[model samples]
Target: MKYIKIKRVMDFIFSLILLIVISPIMLCAAVAIKCGGQGPVLFKQERPGKDGVIFTIYKFRTMRLETEKDGHPLSDMERMTRVGMMLRKLSIDELPQLLNILRGNMSFIGPRPLLIQYLERYTPEQMRRHDVTPGISGWAQINGRNGIDWETRFEYDLWYVKNISFLTDLKIFLGTLAVILGTRGVNQSKSQTMEEFGVATKSLKG
Candidate 1:
């Protein structure tokens, strides 16, 4: 109880400080996004958070809106603009999530919130990830991020949830910084981002 309260306080304080420090960079990112192409400056999507609650997650728009000859949307790589590519490489596109942290919709450290549509796809054990607030970075992210398989990712998330502590969060936070600086595991092979978890096998009932 004490730790949870302390962590929440730390999250609030750090989020505010970082928001102030990164305002200029965020403004620059917004302008760059506008100059890159047409579309909203921010991309908002509903994601499952702590206790399976849903919240709108915010990110800087990094893809151009376009349709194919069949009127279907193009792949993420196809829609990625030059500036978008740069922003993604530097992870500047994730800065908007600071607002989520400020709103208490997220934490600085926890399992990364996944799409809401995946709720029914999770196995009973996997569903434990929602036991804590989602985060901009997590044990899974710092481990192998998009480079790992879904099973491994969930295992890492569960591990973090079961062993969450100040020291653990600090290690994951620092590891995230290293991963971002190295620009590692930003995307999976043959995809601009990690693939979504669609319908799960019937054997692994949610």
Candidate 2:
């Protein structure tokens, strides 16, 4: 329990420092988005946080405003702008989440927050990932990110929940740097992002 408190302090202090250090990069990203003719510089979405609490997660907008193109709905890749793609590739899009970290809505490491719709879909075991604050990068992220299947990803998240500690977080942080530099697992093998959890089947588990 003390480490949890320590982790929150670390999240707050480091996120504050990182935000200040990265302000210029965030500004450049914002300008690029605006110049790209996108509707907004930032994308805001509701995500389930710790204990399934609802909170807004922020990222640099990475897709076009229009849902449809030339009479058909646009795929995520189709909607992605050149600048947006660059931002995503460099992981610049996630810098704004430092604010979420500062606000105590998230941590630097834990289970990545997921869509609000997913709150009801998780198995009781899977829902334990929400016992800690959501994070920008976590055990699942360093393991495989969007590249892995939902079951595997949830397994990693639960592992982190059970073994969260300074060393665990440090390992994830180091691995994240490698992942970003390598740009592996940023997207699914065949999709811009992974498919929605439990979408193909009626339930995750019988």
Candidate 3:
């Protein structure tokens, strides 16, 4: 569809512009992470994108290097640092995903990429959310983000799949600004993040 093509162009242009504009902030974030003695400034993870194809998603590291002296991974709260929390609350940690957008692995507005393990868990209908490229922000993100349940999130994803258009993307683009400024749904008040898809486990970051 023409809209899909147009959306890709928009993603490319916007991601490039955003990267240029935010480079300084990203630089500062990298310095802060290094100063905090965290493992790395950027966190890379394999996430499923369109049609369940895996791609590396990037984010600024927001967790401590280790939770235990024995090389064990840290629990969500244990790994969270003050700097990490501040970046997360400001939604600055996700700025690295603009690179994903530029790389053609993602869109600026679509269903947010999810973990690879979720490929097997999604029902046939839920899997439809992957019909388009995954995004850094999406209809689901603007709706409730980390606060919403898996079922509802999937519903929003599916809705976007069926209703994608320039106007829809514009609305999401604007709504994302509001969400970021307000930090309304970075994490659920009852918990740090929504439970993992079909797993009930917490995530690395919200």
Highest lDDT: which candidate?
A: 2
Give one digit per residue, the lDDT tens place, for model 1 in 66-176: 755387767777778888888887889988898999899999999999988788888889999999889999999999988887878889999999999999999998998
**Would you list the clashing residue pairs of candidate 2?**
none
Candidate 1 colliding pairs: none
Q: How far out, in Å, is residue 92 in model 1?
A: 1.1
**After superposing candidate 1, which stretches have Cα over 4 Å from the reference?**
67-73, 199-206
Better of 2 and 3 by TM-score: 2
Q: Tens digits of per-residue lDDT for model 3 on 1-206?
A: 99888888888998999899989999999999889883878999999888788889999999876756567654665668889989998988999999999999999888988888878787788889889999888999999988888778888999999999889989999999999988887876443454677766333112
Cα distance off (Å), candidate 3, residue 200: 2.9
Ranking by TM-score: 2, 1, 3
Residue-level lDDT of model 2, residues 86-109, one tens digit each, is: 887789999999999999999999
TM-score of each: 0.93, 0.96, 0.91
lDDT comparison, 1 vs 2, better candidate? 2
